[model samples]
Target: MKQTIPGLIAAIMALSSCSQRTTTTNHVKVKENPVNTKVTEQALDKGLFATLKIKNEFKTGEPVKLKFTVYNSTDSVKEFCKWHTPFEPLMSKYLEIKEANGEEAAYQGPMAKRMMPPPASSYQKINPGDSLSVDVDLLKGYAVQKPGRYTLSYTGQGMSGLVVKDSVVFHILP
Candidate 1:
């Protein structure tokens, strides 16, 4: 009888855990809708410019690739890097980043490691009339699937704040 009671208790505990695991309630309140982000053209090709172009419109859980082009007509070579920021502007006010395919996206590392130092930016040098290309993996952790417009920009860490020489607006439809 003692052995049977212990087994029964274990079974009940297991059942309780299983039930709690899938107890997802849809009573969570919804957040306010986001605002539209403005898209502007930067003549980096003419002077110092950066551009982000995707192969196609992105969708939730859809595999995609982004092509970034940095054009520097200046005397010095411009540097560039990539980032996935989802919380800025709270959406509607500006383009924001969100999880894609139900997964968070960003270079996994410490803040110092992920963000480059001023003048020692993420991108390398792009000399006069020179252009640089980078391929971004849309899977394996880094993706945004909220289905909205996003601004992918090249920002350089500067003394004042950040220098955004160029940017592009892309859309992801649900």
Candidate 2:
């Protein structure tokens, strides 16, 4: 009976801690001011990550296809909202694209106004050591008119607790 009591207590503790999204840590605690949490993008879980990839180059007015993948390297399953991601139709401009001169490419896609805590249908699940990918054409959303090198990244909060590594570069020909 004594051993059973300790095992039960441990089980309860594990279950209780599984559903929490925020934790208290000196530099990583949830901020009292919501505005300060904007920088929390840098504080996302390292276990879940996103990456952007593109082809070598593109011609002016050609399709600049982008391949975005979300990887779950942890032992547990991870989930993220697919609303602002490429898994859905291009309804919102969630990508940040910059020209070679550092000017942001204008977003020419439709803008969608959403409510907080998105609908349950907007979520996607990825299992451990698995990845989900979606390919989208940048030309359909952002105005990639300039013929030069450009950097593309997933800056949207689609996958709630993951950081997107901005390392994709592509060039456009005149």
Candidate 3:
């Protein structure tokens, strides 16, 4: 019988490819947690010298640390400049991140006019009580997945207009 109609059409194409591979593996293990549960905590001390600390609480896939401090406390040398070159330096450009129904965590790579380079300059000198520290890992430049509350602001501009702002309030648990 024609090999029983090609073995019943190969058993209905192997049961429709095993039910579409178990519905695409159950839709990729169903993951949904775009942060939302009504929570608020605001803290800001708008730059005057420099200080931005982050890490209130985190444990949902970890990795979000930012600690920047730049204070010369005046009385002599205090020169810091960098025309362009930021994918780090605490990710400046007046960094600001907000999430908790306010969105804005989409700075996810390849756009900074395409990794800037052409017009450049650089300098750094903080003396007389000195202070210049930087540590950043905010998921390698934002796009902070799921979890919860987050607000981080930074204003670090040096040279002639010397300014350094700070703000932090973070929490991400699951």
Candidate 4:
């Protein structure tokens, strides 16, 4: 019986330690203030990720489509996160719009590298293993525009403690 007592105590100690094991999710923690508050809300949702792609181009007044893929890894889809204008000045500083002939174009409202609030018609959703695409023109509805490379960057936060960022590079040509 004494032998059994030690064995039982050993089993109890092992089981108690197992309870202390913690499950930590693999995600990047955002220590700094978010560029947008919506990022904080989205970071709580699972399976939320954004994919960005940029194409090199050399034409002005042409379409410069920006595509984003929002996907959910879990079965439930949440709309806690929304697209907001980026506050980072660097986000605007990196975009360079030159003429097709290699001349600098006139400065417009916000630079291309900055993030813009989604238009009124903008609503993005993602389901489990599903992704969506967004397209925007380089200089929507413009003419006599310059041709040059354009860079874009977007930041997003997921509810699952995931922060995603994407950068794109495009150019305008004659």
| Stretches of model 1 off by over 4 angstroms after superposition | 1-47, 75-110, 113-123, 138-143, 146-167
Supply the global lDDT for candidate 4.
0.41
lDDT of each: 0.40, 0.68, 0.51, 0.41
Each prediction's RMSD over C-alphas, in Å, is: 21.0, 13.7, 23.1, 17.5
Candidate 4 residue lDDT tens string, 1-174? 989999998766543321111223333333332223243344334445555555666455556665544544444443323323121221222233444355544434453431233332333444434455555443532232554455555523311122455455666677
Off by over 4 Å in 2: 1-46
Query: Candidate 1 residues 1-174, lDDT tens each?
Result: 989999998766543321101122333432221212222343423244444556546777776565544444444433432232111211111112344332323533223322223223323444444555555534433345557665554433221111334455556779
User: Which 10 residues in a row give candidate 1 its minimum summed lDDT?
Assistant: 85-94
> Which predicted model would earn the best TM-score?
2
- Estimated TM-score for each candidate: 0.40, 0.70, 0.26, 0.43
Which window of ten consecutive residues has the lowest lDDT sum in model 4?
Answer: 85-94
Evaluated at residue 100, the lDDT of candidate 1 is 32
What is the full ranking by lDDT, best candidate first?
Answer: 2, 3, 4, 1
Error of 1 at 86 (Å): 16
Candidates ranked, most accurate by TM-score first: 2, 4, 1, 3
Tens-digit lDDT string for candidate 2 (1-174): 999999998766544322213222233222232121122344344455677778988999888898877765545556666766887898887888888888999999998876545666766776665678888989888888779888887776533445675567899999
